[model samples]
Target: MIKRLTKHGNSLALVIDRPVLDLLEIDDQTPLSVTTDGKCLIIAPAPDEKRRQSFQSALKKVNKRYGRALKKLAE
Candidate 1:
């Protein structure tokens, strides 16, 4: 889908379509990570650092409880 860039005060903005936003499961306040690879621009949802830390902590606990089993499985 093509979207036109519009002027927003001193900056330009592209209005994201509702359907596209729904498909991406993003809201108006959703954080985004934008970067450029050569001439191509990439946009994606930013990782939730708090959620990530919680997940890492949970993984550590699980590993501690099942370390022997996991090590056996890896063999």
Candidate 2:
């Protein structure tokens, strides 16, 4: 889908269509990461706070289980 870039004060913006927004599971207030790989553009929704916390907790658990190994490796 093509979207025109319009002026918004000092910045330009492209308004995504509703269907596309639904497919991307993004709402107006959703946080997103945008990047360009060569000529292609990438847009992805930022991880949810709760999900991020869960991942951190899981990582901590794994680190604790392997703490002795990690300490040996560090030495």
Candidate 3:
């Protein structure tokens, strides 16, 4: 979707759509990380360290429990 920045005081702000925010599980309270590669801008929710650790723990357990089956399926 195309978006145009709106004037906000001395700076411009991009208003994100509600549906997109809901899909990304982002809210007003969520921290956003903004970056660019010189050609364009990229905005996204900041990584949650706690969430990352939890996911890693679950992944390790799953690997331990189903590593053989998963590797077999990959073949």
Candidate 4:
């Protein structure tokens, strides 16, 4: 959807749709990451470092327990 930037104090702010925020499971309290690649502007929820570490730890545990079985199944 096309959106226009709204004036906010000395800055222009883009208003995100409620449904879009709901779909992404992000609330006003959620930190946002904004970046651009020369031409296009990208906006998304910032990566949670703690969550990433937790996931990595869980993956290591699972791999240690089932790595051989999983490898055999893949073959």
lDDT of 2 by residue, 1-73 (tens): 5678999999998888899899888998999988999998888897789999999999899899998899899
What are the TM-scores, per candidate, against the unseen true structure? 0.77, 0.60, 0.71, 0.85
Highest lDDT scorer: 4
Ranking by lDDT: 4, 3, 1, 2
Candidate 3 lDDT (Cα, 0 to 1) = 0.96
- The candidate 3 region of ten consecutive residues with least summed lDDT is 39-48
Q: Per the 3 Å backbone cut-off, how many clashing residue pairs does candidate 2 have?
A: 0
Give the per-residue lDDT digits (tens) of candidate 3, residues 1-75.
Answer: 988999999999999999999999999999999999999889889999999999999999999999999999999
lDDT for 17 (candidate 2)? 85
User: What are the lDDT figures for the candidates, one per model?
Assistant: 0.91, 0.90, 0.96, 0.97
Residue pairs with backbone overlap in model 4: none
* Model 1: residue 40 alpha-carbon error in angstroms: 2.1
Better model by lDDT: candidate 1 vs candidate 3: 3
Per-residue lDDT of 75 in model 4: 100
Residue 59 local lDDT, model 3: 100
lDDT of 1 by residue, 1-75 (tens): 667899999999888888888999999799999999999778888999999999999999999999999999999
- As for candidate 2, its clashing pairs are none
Off by over 4 Å in 1: none
Which of 1 and 4 is ahead in TM-score? 4
